[model samples]
Target chain A: MADATDSSDPVDALLATVDDGDVAFDGLRLEPVADGDDGRFALETPTLDRSTFGRSELRDVLETVEEYVTNWYYWQGDVGGEGTARRAFLRWCERAPVVGEAVTAPSAETTLEANRTARETANGTAPETTAEADQSLQVPQRQDALRDGIDREWGQLCITARFVDVDEPDGVRVYDLWHVDDADSDVADLEVYDDPRTAREIATTDEDGRYRPLKTAPTLPSGWAFTGLSGDELVETVGSVYPATIANWHRERLGELDVDHWLETAERQTGIYDVVDELPRDAVEWMADACCVDSQCLRRREWEYEEGDELDVDGGDGPFPCREPCSLVVAAARKWAILESETERTYELELTTSEFNQLGELIDAVAEGRTDEIREADLGDGANRYRARYLRAKRFDDDGLEARKRPEEY
Target chain B: MQALVVAAHGSHLNPDASDPTYAHADAIRETGAFDEVREAFWKEEPHFREVIRTLESEEVFVVPLFISEGYFTEQVIPRELRLEGWDPEQWDSDGTSATEVTLSVGDANKTVHYCGPVGTHDAMTDVIVGRAERVTEDPDVGEGFGLAVVGHGTERNENSAKAIEYHTDRIRERDRFDEVQALFMDEEPEVDDVTDFFESEDVVVVPLFVADGYHTQEDIPEDMGLTDDFRLGWDVPAAVDGHRIWYAGAVGTEDLMADVVLERAADAGAELGDAIEIVRAGAGGSVTEPADVDGTAGTTKTGD
Candidate 1:
């Protein structure tokens, strides 16, 4: 088994990690590609395998995975920057327990911080400028708090507290705190106090009025707590509310796969085929000389099939080229069979051949607006019953045929 | 071939509310254009669910016989028909855009085209004009006569008034009458104030409704002082308040509406061929070209 970190190229390094054995997670299997791009990969399941699909098919499958992952977690700016495939993979590893442990990838926060540092270093910035960079990052936090103040003054707000090594501002670590205040106005403007009671006093005190102590301490909102969660716990908390964002972050980390090719192969194997000489032949060619129904499907001159292989066909004697019946052929055959069977049966009619022709002419005359007379054929009981059924059938086809007849009153 | 279902907001107390709707269904049925012509209502017998149960065709077209694109047309009809892309529970008061939806019902797949209410069609304006003309002694000599279009306006939704206002504007554009005023039974300018807006001695009042239900037969006539009896059939020009008020039946009950109904069905993809002839034959009279009343000659607008 090849190790991921051994290769210089990140994609190659990741591909080398997939062993010969199947790696399954959430019903998706990451299988090694035998012949593909240098680091090509395939994802499969019981019913679907990327290796059997064509180029466009595989591409759609891969794109679906990509889109799903992107929508899930990467949508949140908290994850790695867009288009950073390596960082995206690392994020996936951190989220997907099986895949994450298999690759031994670093945490999402660590990778995020590392990428940021690398980006800053590439921009020709010195290590000493880290302190200035930290200050700029705090701007968003301040803006969020200010906006929250304008919207409402109630509820517990989350605030971050930073404790820096006094001698080294660059060696700072941050901690989060849930700030609960009962004040109805300017909650953002109040200074941080020891607890909710003190915070409320400073927030509620009028500009010209003296500070007064409350008789009863205010109760915090149900879930309010002094200590805040961080790292994985923080990611999990955010993921719970925005599952799509989390799913994207995890999927993108699974690395890229050749999805279009796999999809095409899968489609070719599933559609209608002609069973002849105990082999599956192109059903389209045998039935109709037309391309596959799928507009984007690849036109194949020959389809490979093995003898005695149980093809997925309706009412087929054995494993043959034609696996299943196309809807067009089945419908045509069914109609033809019905017509053939109906021709064999005879109906006793009371009307002569000449009278039947007159009836047809009269019906046409009414439809063409030549006459308004509604004349009924005076056939006997059995024939009249059959005529009524025939009229009912015609009514189903042309709702207005009978209406063209003038009533007896007219 | 598709099944055409005429969906109506049926009445519980007044059975006559769905009369025009049923008449329209019979007219369409005679046309022979659709495989099946059925009537479905929100509140009456042969309910929507029951009507859907009898649908054997794979494609269906639901034409709402509403006077306007109001709450019933926008929400109720679509829900009852199971038209694609609509969820009655998900609907909000903000209103939804009128778009046709294709949905599947049971083993058969159906593309349901929920058309606009018949009253909103431009052709209906011609029916209203025809109804007004029929009741008046001489419709051509209309230089001094007033036309009052009565509608069942509601305080619950503003769409009812909007529809009436639209017809009033269309009628005014014709320049046939001296004055055309849109009055509502519920909202302002109330139907009771019909005489206030007109100075003409002879006023032709046409009900812009689908049927001669409670509102059109009872409420509108009583408000306009056309009849104090509160009966189902009021004699035209019931001399009242020193003005000769010529009361007409609901615009939807006009024979010309059979053409509009077929036009609506055709808009929903029902082929119009022998069906047109069928409607003409059933009408028992010369079928007026829909182009004559649709305002836009040769152009028929369906589903609004």
Candidate 2:
């Protein structure tokens, strides 16, 4: 509900906020990147750009990052030290949802309407989409495949993380990526090696502070039903969580302009700061982060909201594979189905009391996540349907009768 | 004869962690089906490498006791087991026989079939809910007050947390609590955060951890901001902050483990022929001792 003719141009203000680390989950991504050839980036690319630290420290920073990746014991707990940039780059990727089959620039008026819809969605109310997101997704798949061609050229990207442990059974090695290489840099993207193994090694961490296997992650999957659903829904959900200001704006501005258009804009433009070129700093960034749209990040990110701060959460209604501790039980059920595919279908998981309890315990032990363990039980059915159980507590009298207390006295 | 190795990621830190598998192995014995039933570990005695070699049976059914399908259950265990020659499609689901060892039985009756991990059953939800309820003395703790399930969280993979949430949701669906929240030690909505997360003026916290470790006695309650006398029973006085807190033993401590383990064994055995003979792990002494297993204080508690 920005003023139709406010003196302070919202875009310029928004861009300034992006520069100050504002992230919007409900509107267009408003990132201020170094736009490269032909207007993809902004002008700050060539000349000295805005930064808190000097460029002279880039090598030292990069080396510090290497040392941390190579050894957690060294710099993991250290503050103000240069570290991995993978996080910074991934944040960039999170904003830059690979655009495909370029369309003519959306008119300023069209964008204005889109931004409004995004604002509405930011307020936790539902806005039905007539235009299919499925359409956008399809466009990307076709274009990416077509552009890459049948005999595709694979691009190498370097990624790194802190080392937890190393286990090699067959030839494959999997490294747990806690801190990625480009986590601290303003440069939004990373250039990593294509091969997963090489990626692990090159982006290695040390024993004390960090380490990454030279291995790379698997190529992005072709059909992303589960993953896409999880991440996209989160993005959309956090985008739509009730923002205090937007709600206020809507309540007051309902009779002023086109409410529907505003709602639509907000819905489509979620995380505009996280994903766009010139996002402004606003309360929405703070709010949607609590709403957490990217499901993959749920149960994974750990930062406490200050006292008196309301939490925006990734609702329990997030995508599969869920974050921990929910993932612990869910993965157990999934493992039952997948490993025993020959006999038990997905529906007939034979969760023993102990494993079931273990799974539940793992979930409860977690600190922050939207959904509880129970939701996962109801997910897959008919063999794909999973089963789980945990230990129930109580004291038995000499008579072996179960004792009970009233619901409120305890 | 084919054999199924029930591999548990055993912990030397907490003996209770491995209790269920040992109990389950006993249940499988009464039916006398498998040529071999054993517990191997990633940490405890008889490590994975050692356990594989102990499988005198050629065709071994390697079943991991992990609650996740992540890297470990899928990639690491399979790789360690050298299952390239074993077609999952061809392997037996019952602990019957294996072809890897000429001595290994391959019959649905005699073969060693590897069953899936005991993580995907609806029955487990019942056990978890039941345990959470039993742990408190405060009537307010069970059916209505906010229920928070705390688990150990690590940044290794998303599957770990997914597995935990799967259980909490199950309990929530029963309509037992005014609110049910899943929190993690390493993640958000932490044990301490639950008190704040709870809009319900007061809440009962349940530690869903697998053992009676530092997390249970210290981290969990500390997070809850409780002080002295904040013992884990119903209406326990808080030592730090005088919050009425109920301490529940690790949900895994339910004493009915023997029965459930037996049921699983029977199910696996039934898949094979009905006339399988039970071979006890310790030929002389009973593995199914039905002796007291201290489920509390991590001590001996008789299985009901």
Candidate 3:
């Protein structure tokens, strides 16, 4: 720790502000000692027991806090930056809120309740208040209460914040990032990554070791965590796992995201992808419904059919904006366009009601990529591998489904 | 004047998709021709749509390190970079390649010159011949060996096949190989018919692709009957039916690609001034002479 009087270092500059009385910030409390020459200070946090410290020891404690707060400001920018998604997320981590309505409104309610208790006491009768009302009066106490750990799900990532020392909030505060699927596993069990580039390697494959052509696909592999990351390191590691997501999320909050819709994007295609423009308008809506849903991609689709012409489908509920149709969507649209060109045909096949519903379940399982999740032992599920095999064995022939010939043959 | 941006298509599943672009950029950066050499990818970090915002450079040279001039080179890259006079309507109507496009970026109106892809350059024929010749140890120097340039051709884009045919014709004009044919992975006269395409005892197959991903690593070798079970970095020079087959790695990942990228930039009118001279001019406010940058050479292995 540098000299506490030094005005240049950020931590020192902040500590120098503690003068006569106690000061509180982000759950840490500091009080200046009466000893003038020693420049001692008393410190306390929700978890850390109250203790007296000389200048150097106090400086060491404040250094770690200053680093965490400084990095938070650097990556998160001003606390009041626009967009409520990240702001709500930060508040969930026990950090102070940008808008203090949630904090200040409760204090006002307690103040009103406190005045009622004063009036009851002045009536010369034993003052009585319900425990529920008394709980509201302890607003400041709630704010000072110790929190063991906090976790929130952002897209596929499970972000966690925990105190590093035994019951010492002033000690190092560490953050961990991992796949939400691995939330139940021990940190020691998961593969650990310190560098941001390792996140890229982990994001390259799925649970069954298949290449994930789309990073936003709902098939992220589990069993990995990036622990003990600083604020900027956490942000950088998350960005590597899902590139441009943080930037786009921030841009959406700032109201500066530029969205290129489907028609304009398709019109610009010059080669084989040019056929994507030939898709019927209704088919385009189907395409968005198929590929842009939250079950398929993590990004919320911001682009519409044109500019203000919205598709009749629900765009995902992701915090980040898609901005435009991705390459995967374009590639899928091209195939759909050619398939749409062929004349439609209806074939007659005999099936029971249960078998008919099974076909729908089979399509849903494959479309949502949940076929792998259904186990062969779970034969009750229509999409179970052995169940589907039995259905295929019963209905499908070498010629076609239910031994039906091609429509052209008729 | 400020930086060289090598833009290419990247993969989320396969890191090998962008390895060649990164290697080429690193090789070019070593020459000290520009103050910075950065890479932008369609599917990776620093995406093409926002790569310019990451740069403080006022003037940049954008080279598309792709294999062909098609959807990406003519349309996707130009639009993403927001070129000044790029009219996609015009490209779609005429089906003509945009050899060079210049876009003004940021408040400073930074000059961004978008150069054509390196794959279609005439210099690629030399790289292809070098790849074919290097695969064999025969003292005959690939004189009697038939050469097959394999490409991932799709029915959706004619340009993919045209790129392969262009190199095959150029290589045939030299009269070096006994036979030259354009084989595709998805089109007619596929790579599976390599043995039937040539009657020569020895045949050299070169994949005219940008990177050694699934296509080059597994699919092509499996199609050629070279290996029944293929993995990454499969062995070459296997014998089948008394015919010697020499399979080369993807042509685009060659180390000499640095020079090919520079040639494409030079064709787009880039002034390759030495970075040391530029720095001296910034400090002293004047320069007596500007050194000419030597082109990069030599073949080195790609990817870690």
In the range A1-410, model 3's lDDT, one tens digit per residue, is 22222444445445665763455443445788787779888776444567888988887886645533332322223332223333333443443322211222344544433333333322333223322111221213322331355576668999876555534343234678898888898888988888765776787778888767677877888888998776545655666566666656544433457788999989976566879999999999999988899888898999999988999898887756788888778778889999999876667788889999998999989987788789769988999888788888889888658644357576
What TM-score does prediction 1 earn? 0.38
lDDT scores of the candidates, listed in order: 0.46, 0.36, 0.66
* Ten-residue stretch with the least lDDT total in model 2 chain A: A168-177
- In the range B1-304, model 2's lDDT, one tens digit per residue, is 5455667665433445555565555455455565655566554434443344334344555555544344555444543444443443343322212112211222111233344444433444554555554554333345546667666766776656665676678878878787888888897756665556666544555555433444555456556665432244212333323334554545544433333333344444423344222322222222212111121233322110
Report iRMS (Å) of candidate 1. Answer: 27.0
Error of 1 at A151 (Å): 76
Candidate order (lDDT): 3, 1, 2
* Tens-digit lDDT string for candidate 1 (A1-410): 11223544322322343444433322234555668655455765323434644333544664434322221222122232333322322232222212222211244543333334333322332222211111121112222332222121111234333322223222112223343342333435444333322322332222334221110112222223322232233332222211122333222223211112211222332112111222224332332222222211111112222323322322211101111222223333334433444323333334557556656765555444344233355443223435546645654345433343233343
Question: Per model, how many backbone clashes are there?
Answer: 41, 217, 0
- Runs of candidate 3 exceeding 4 Å displacement: A1-8, A11-153, A159-176, A181-186, A228-236, A375-379, A403-410, B1-5, B10-61, B68-71, B87-101, B105-111, B120-205, B213-235, B239-245, B255-304
Evaluate residue B201 in candidate 2 and report its C-alpha lDDT on the 0 to 100 scale: 43
On lDDT, who's better, 1 or 2? Answer: 1
Candidate 2, residue B170: Cα displacement in angstroms equals: 1.8
Taking all chains together, each candidate's TM-score versus the true structure is: 0.38, 0.33, 0.63
Pairs in steric clash, model 3:
none
State the lDDT of candidate 3 residue by residue for B1-304, as single tens digits.
4778899888654656776776677667666886657678776656787666444457788888887777788777777777767755533322224366666753234788877777777777877776765566442455778999998888888888888898899989988888999999999999987898898888888888777666776677778887776632344576766778788768876666677787777667776655323322332110100010010111112221
After the best TM-score superposition of candidate 3, give how far the Cα of residue B199 lies from its true spot, in angstroms. Answer: 12
